[model samples]
Target: MRNVSIDELDDTPRVVVAIGTDYAHGHLLARHTHRRAQLLYGATGVMQVSTHDGSWVVPPQRAVWIPAGVAHEVLMLGVSTRSLYIEPEAVDLGRQCQVIDVSPLMRHLLMEAVEAPLNYDEAGRDAVLMDLLLHELARSTHLPLHIPLPVEPRLLGLCQAFVQQPNAHQSPRQWADQLHISLRTFNRLFRQQTGLSFSQWRQQACVVLALARLATGTPVTRIALDCGYESPAAFSTMFRRILGQAPSVWLAATNS
Candidate 1:
């Protein structure tokens, strides 16, 4: 795992740190929780952060707001990553966990925040800068891509299997075979329980897997192949269709 220690940060009521990397292995950070609420931004790369309730894939143009005290893991896909972590008490508007769009003002302010020198002054221009940063966060948009996972042991077991092997491409029939259920019954139950068809659920699983790999800087071609795509071009096309941009362009426009 590629790691960066964030200890010894300045003594502001909230902490802000900037992280940028270009490592490729499909895993960037581990599962951990912090006392502070965290805002995870990926200026580049697609990132996946999962909590017990759901998994979130944060695009380069967006950030994830993790409420203080929630335990979650971070997964990085291919492309470079420039992230900013903010303390929860730093901002009052975004107190809950969510994924929100990072505006240009917010992005610029974050860059400035990270570049600002640490100090202990009680009042000054620095204090004003901090307040502006908090305001920018409130103006950001919230995007919907949280993948809520089922809590049942049986369902979770299946989810774990798929996460371990994203390219499995198993059909409901195959899933039924493994679970010792009739294909028709499995299909009915899966939709009834998850509000998604077997294929839809699998696509969501695949996308999250793709997000994790992309955040780690895995090659688009290799990720596509690993995720069972026939070719990188095909994968990019699909990614653009779904994400509104080609992978490389998305990466470039999001962060730096």
Candidate 2:
């Protein structure tokens, strides 16, 4: 159903409910939770999803899977979303949130599903389509768009600050000194808490942050400088290394 709130139909007998909603640029959906797992697809624009654990940048044509009951917030940028809310028992997409690619077939299926009735006939063509949608979701490839947050209070504070003003040249030694810990200890603790080495996590954070600006037609050179890269070429190199496409190429795909 287009533009309908899921809360109003949360008790529908169907295992899955699909809805589409459009948002103005830079709209923020404050922290909330759902009883059903959600496949939140961005048919256009970008989405920034955050939870206690970390944040994810969902690029255009991609989606983020939010497990049931995970309190999260979304910052939508010129987004038109197609969301599937599925009963927890009906799917096993793991307990963690993930960003996943939307195949062409799955994209068309999502468009179709959102147009189906809230209580689509279980024995009809819509039922078959919903089944196919679930299958597509189960087999979808997860993307490396998540930036996990560290839990240690001191370290978490530093990490949070870095995310606000990401600098590629920021070193672990600097963070360690601020925390009054040895570099070795900081590195070990960072990896243990976030499952990513300091450098890897920093790069991921820069890319994800850059994506939000990139969506709004920000130039690569401007984003590079803002992200603390010395040159757009250097920034594009790292962006390609992490996302497998140069910033311009990715932007073209997003705009297309």
Candidate 3:
């Protein structure tokens, strides 16, 4: 027999339970851990999930899967969340956090799942609905919304500074000089530490930060300037290139 409960009390082959919650703008759920793997859907607004490994941004109509026992924190940018708690044995969603697009069907199913009883019946409609939910989550596309952070002390310092003031106009050479290192050393060590080239890492940082700001009703024109893009079109171009959707289109869709 299968089982479903927000709390794990057995080693069942199929277990999934859900809960619905809302958060006001700028709400932050401090670092925490859960016994069950979680699939959190941002039915409205946007969400930012961070772990020591990396950070992921979930825009509206998107969701994030966090593996069981991984420590994480979620920052809500005016989003309502429908969170599914699954027994680790029930799914192999990898050992990392992932942001994924929510299909229209999956979106509706999540809303329906949240209203389900604490322990859903295995032979009922809720079971079928839960099965479909798991299938959709496993098949969802993984988005490119992650920014992996470095662990080296000096590089970590530089990364922190860069994130604080993301200037697209700033070059790797300039950053290297700030750290008193040669451009060649900076290039090599940056990739070694962050698993991405300096330019690539900077772009990821910019996009992540830009998404958070955009979620709060900031205009593309102003955000571009703040993030140090030369022009709105340039910013949009990079946003589309990296995220596969224009800023205006994404912001509009999320708000609608």
User: Which runs in model 1 stand beyond 4 Å of their true positions?
Assistant: 1-30, 42-48, 57-62, 75-97, 117-123, 143-147, 181-197, 212-221, 230-237, 252-256
lDDT of 1 at 238: 66
On the 0 to 100 scale, the lDDT of residue 180 in model 1 is 85
Q: State candidate 1's TM-score.
A: 0.67
Q: Write the per-residue lDDT of candidate 1 for residues 1-256, one digit (tens) a residue.
A: 1234444442444455554446573775777776656667666667778878767888766788887778788777654554445666666544345888888888776666555545423376655665676677767777645665666678778867777777635788887887788988888878876677877777666665676556556789988888787898887876776566777886666546
The residue ranges of model 2 lying beyond 4 angstroms of the native Cα positions read none
What are the lDDT scores of the predictions, listed in order?
0.67, 0.94, 0.84
Q: TM-score per candidate, in order?
A: 0.67, 0.98, 0.91
By lDDT, is 2 or 3 better?
2
Q: Using lDDT as the measure, which candidate wins?
A: 2
- Report the poorest 10 consecutive residues by lDDT, candidate 3: 1-10
Better of 1 and 2 by lDDT: 2
Task: Please list all clashing residue pairs in model 3, or write none if there are none.
Answer: none
Off by over 4 Å in 3: 1-14
Instruction: List, residue by residue over 1-256, the lDDT tens digit for candidate 2.
Output: 9999989999999999999999999999999999999999999989999999999999999999999999999999999999999999998989889999999999999999999988899999999999999999999999889999988898899889988988999999999999889999989999999999999999999998898788878899999999889999999999999999999998897777
Ranking by TM-score: 2, 3, 1
**Residue 256, candidate 1: how far off, in angstroms?**
5.8
RMSD of each: 5.0, 0.9, 3.3
